[model samples]
Target: MPIPMNAEPNDGCEGAVKGAGENIVAVSPAALSPDDEVALRRAIGELRRESLAMRLTALIGRQIGFIGLMVPEPIAETINKTAESALRSAMGIALASLGDRSTRDRRGLHKSVATMAGAAGGAFGLAGLPIELPFTTTVMLRSIADIAKSEGEDLSDPDVALACLEVFALGSSGAANPIERGGALEAGYFALRSLLAKSVSQAARHLLDRGLSNQASPLLVRFIAQVSARFGVVVSQKLAAQSVPLIGAASGAAINYAFVDHFQTLARGHFTMRRLERIYGIVMVRAEFERLARQI
Candidate 1:
């Protein structure tokens, strides 16, 4: 999708994204040109579509776990271990990737994610849960960091990097919870919205200036992981999908693709929302988001 270069504050919204927008006291719809209106429509449309997709994947991920349970007890336990290990590895690599942006080939990175996902499936088939998990997790987190960068954040700043990590929580929206009718992902986005850096600026600031690695206190790392677990139900679902024998290398590859792409969309819209909040004020953007979310 073509990203809007100059558009701000009016990107993704819950309700109709036409005719410029409603007039705010500080900014008027009269200022919007025809092109701006079109861009807003496209931007909001993409966010809505991606949000819906994330919900669908979450629902599907939950159901897939039972199928894996059909496997033998011994094998199931092993797969679970693999899944946890994969997540740990992915978490480390993804964080490391954020520290460097000098050598980036997003296209190449996409290929690498696919390749790793495919290889894991082929080598272990349904048994390669450990390998598959890390591939998708790492790739999605990297995509999150990339989205942060596009939203004008410096990944070098620990606060920005922490925000990217929190995108994983967005996945928790429909995990095992009763999705609010049509508002699964939408509701999830709102729930975690407060957890984002803008909403949690004070906490993020402390982590930003402190040494990330050399000075990263155990207290801080533990704090981040604890906050992260608040939305960790979805991670369980993703791991559950590993048990499906029906999805081999090709299946694994497809799942990884969807996983990364879904987060990329989330990160894009999320960062876009933050950018909008900066221009139009947090209260207005959030109110509009909540309103539009109901429609979704």
Candidate 2:
């Protein structure tokens, strides 16, 4: 389904808004001249390339960060391999779904794409150092959910997906506008509630174990709580300030984090791989959202 042009922002941010308006005015998807399309395609290609490089860098950074703590090489290796493999598989499935010949065969494929697109959008916004990675990841997921719904998918049953996306949109938007921060916070709190509601009890237990177990060091829990809290604040403020539709950029950021965090946590044994994979299906929906976001 075509992404709604109205969802895009128009406050002179970049060519995305301007181009989107122009395209809307022209009333032709083919209104993009060959030259324009070529340029857009090239830019998108570059963005995709850069996103891949960034993803690799983030992966390596995570590996190195864990290793710096003197983690066992075998455990680190296993974590890195699993995270990389999962990310690659998810991306592959998402891209393929875009071109699936059979519309009927596209349900699962489409969802996967939407999820990843949200992730990619978030990744695009948070590529710099001192990584605000989690915020961007959430935005991506939220964007995916929004996009999927536009395409006629009902995502209400999947609380994890909803929570991740809600937090992302809220956080990213809050970052952009402080007054809106409260909304982002509310959305984030709700998302957390949703995640807990849908989350398997065992998976929650594992997260607590890896994060807050007696055997686990206090430093780890402290770090997780700190980061999570910061994210929560940013997202909540964003949601409070504006409607969800106004926070597309933030939504993209949130989705990106959701996928990355999900995989990383799974690899680190902070969550059950099987349960996480079930949640990972949201990635597909995110990818499609990203594609549509770009078009918009």
Candidate 3:
């Protein structure tokens, strides 16, 4: 005899009896229960709005900062126009990737822009506001890259503007290899040498232009040799992963701080004392690099 659906087994067992023939369990096609389905939809909607707002905010901040730093009005305007176009292209790409067919809220984007502009105006209005040209330029470049990423665009292609950034952050040896031993130490030395070379080269050019050609030759030769040595260090670390944050943060902070010479001196000492500590310091400085990257 067949066991009933609700019957317990009588063979000294307290559990329900198994069916003799094949038994089938039916499952609904929907993975979520009705309440869960509604909750999920609400959550997704909120996330989409939040993401859009954050991107908009970053775009506005970057654009305003770039424009505010330019000294010449015409040049600034030209650069601003070009930057705006680039931003639009990036945003379009992002929207398409997200499957968002709706047009973006221009008013909202403009509002963000206006707010940033106002803040910039107030900050620059103060007397003796030091110019942060390099930091602003870096921010603009990062913004452009972020836009591209959000649009699902591949900035890793050699033809892309973001290739330099990718190489700086992820390393130039491609994804398959690990950093070579002693590469980090070499990178620190090369970076310092590169700075020294730039300083020397600039000084030489200035002296030569002032009709001190005789004085400039010796300095130029020394700078050339320094640059060559720097190149050797760079080559040694060529296979290593570039810590984007470290370089970016250090450079950015150097731009903002007034006593950059003092800071650089301290940095050199740190590099000499401990290689990992130097790298960590650089990473800490460029903490914004990752956050800015994710915005795009």
Give the candidate number with the greatest TM-score. Answer: 1
Total clashing residue pairs per candidate? Answer: 1, 72, 5
lDDT of each: 0.50, 0.30, 0.28
Q: In what order do the candidates fall by TM-score, top score first? A: 1, 2, 3
The residue pairs in collision within model 3 are 93-151, 94-151, 146-296, 246-282, 249-286
Q: Model 3 — which ten-residue stretch has the worst lDDT?
A: 234-243
Report how far residue 186 has shifted in candidate 2, in Å: 6.6
Q: Which ten-residue region of model 2 has the weakest summed lDDT? A: 265-274
TM-score per model over all chains: 0.63, 0.21, 0.17
lDDT of 2 by residue, 1-296 (tens): 12221122222121121221233221222133455334334432322232221232253333222222353555334433332332223222332233212233232343355445544433433222112323333333333443343334333322222222223222222212212122232332223333433222223233334422331334333323333443333322222222223345554444344333332221121112112212222232223223433553
- Candidate 3, 171-194: lDDT as tens digits: 111211221233332233223423
Displacement of residue 216 (Cα, Å) in model 1 is 6.0
